[model samples]
Target: MKRLLNAIRDQFELTHNEAKSALLFFVIILVNLLLYYSYSAYTVNEQSEILIEDYGKTEIPESEERKSNWVDYGSSYKKSAKKVERFSFDPNVATNEQFERLGFPKYLAKTIINYRSKGGKFKYKEDLLKIYSMKPELYADIENLVSLPSKLDKKTPDFDEHRVIAEEKPAFAPKKTFTISKFDINTADTTQLMQIKGIGKVFASRIIKYRDILGGFHSIDQVGETYGLDPTVLPELKKYAVLNTKVKKIRINDLENFRHPYLRYNQVKVIVAYRKQHGNFRNTEDLKQIKILDEATISKIEPYLEF
Candidate 1:
């Protein structure tokens, strides 16, 4: 140690007092570091004990404790469950309480009551199957206990001897025939369309609404697309209806071009993007440039395109 100090003194020419002062300063710093480490350890241990004591003494309110108990026990508690007792029932006349006792859900019981109150009748046991909420398994369980009339009274024919004789006399006479006037489907309003034999207000309105959506019908066959129009009535409608082929044309560049029933949003996006990239479409055939547009779709939408 002394030789090392001599080498240090020779290298830097330090006085003995200066070397001793530097050594003393380093020792003081080392002691301070050790003291700080010990103090920190003691503080951490004291804080941990206080935290554990506070946690052990924490108290929940009574209401919160009760709520927690309910959350844990409510679903499994037998007293909270609905008691269903099977019994013979007539859905048409059974009271709501009776229906409930017979195992019908509360909403279903109310529905059945409302249906009866509105003059709806369960003419047969099978009619209960029409309840929107009645599951097949539940129906199967109660099917045997439901009592309903074998046949409704309205379905029974009323016998009249005098009317029967008059009908038999008229059976030999000729049947009358009527001619229906043909009308233009494009120009015919709901009132005029309802003049057709089987066309009612609902059917006429549907036909007009669909025609407006299409801009106008190009063919009488397109009338078949009207919602709720029966297939059997299509022939009758075709015989009396004529298409003028005058339809409102949609501009290809219009922002609302996607409103057309035949053009989907994606197809419209592709068409608009292509028009911007390659310039406006020159003709209907230019639509084929979009790979997703099949020949069938192009043909269907061609009549409605202006450019």
Candidate 2:
């Protein structure tokens, strides 16, 4: 012990008294820690014994209320084994009920049905793995059961020709015709817009939303600016939708907060700050004074602003 203290003193460049004091302090801490842990272990063991004794003696009475309230977590966690029917069936033609009979969960079966309803096809057995919820283990088990073609003949030289001919033949079938009528773009609601040939629920909703953001459409061409508007549908849309209503304009001086499809956030901030620093904009000429507002930008928004 004396040699260990001498070594520590020499190694740390400490005096005899400092090294002795440190050693004593360390010993005291070690003793305290051991005592603390020993007491904790004894306390824990005593509590455990008490719990065990109480559990052996305790009697829980059976009652309907208790039974109803009590939950068996062990049983809840255990999955009920589904009866899997191993049978060959075409994935593209299989119904939801048939998928369920083949051990697929109801939700996954519905997913397959929805994919088919949206014109998705399974041309190969490997395509079954394309489903997000399809487990590799589950697919491995049923891989032989998929009745799709082994592989697509992608290398066929005349495949494109045959496909084009098949598509062109469908053109000869008499197409169901519907009459399209003209309606005011600004005043027309979603139901009225959906009545047009090309516009559906999604596009109709987007048109109304964009119009609301812009305070209303100023011209028929502005409807074409809607996000994801199909170019082919524009002629049909223009044929039925007319911009006859006057657009609501934003007052330059009284504008507190503005939202426009054309104006970005920072550009708007600069415009508002310019108004505060200089004066309210008189016309498009005053807006051109701000370097950020270029000629084309000012021209685009000129119709929507009022002095």
In terms of lDDT, the best-performing candidate is 2
lDDT by residue for model 1 (85-157), tens: 7778888889999876776766678888998898988867778888766667667777789886543434655
Q: Each prediction's Cα lDDT score?
A: 0.74, 0.79
Best-performing candidate as measured by TM-score:
2
For model 2, the superposed segments whose C-alpha errors exceed 4 Å read: 1-177
Per-residue error (Å), model 1, residue 214: 1.1
Worst lDDT run of 10 residues, candidate 1, spans: 72-81
Error of 2 at 41 (Å): 62
Query: After TM-score superposition, what is the CA distance of residue 128 in candidate 1 from its true location, in Å?
Result: 60
> TM-score of the candidate numbered 2?
0.42
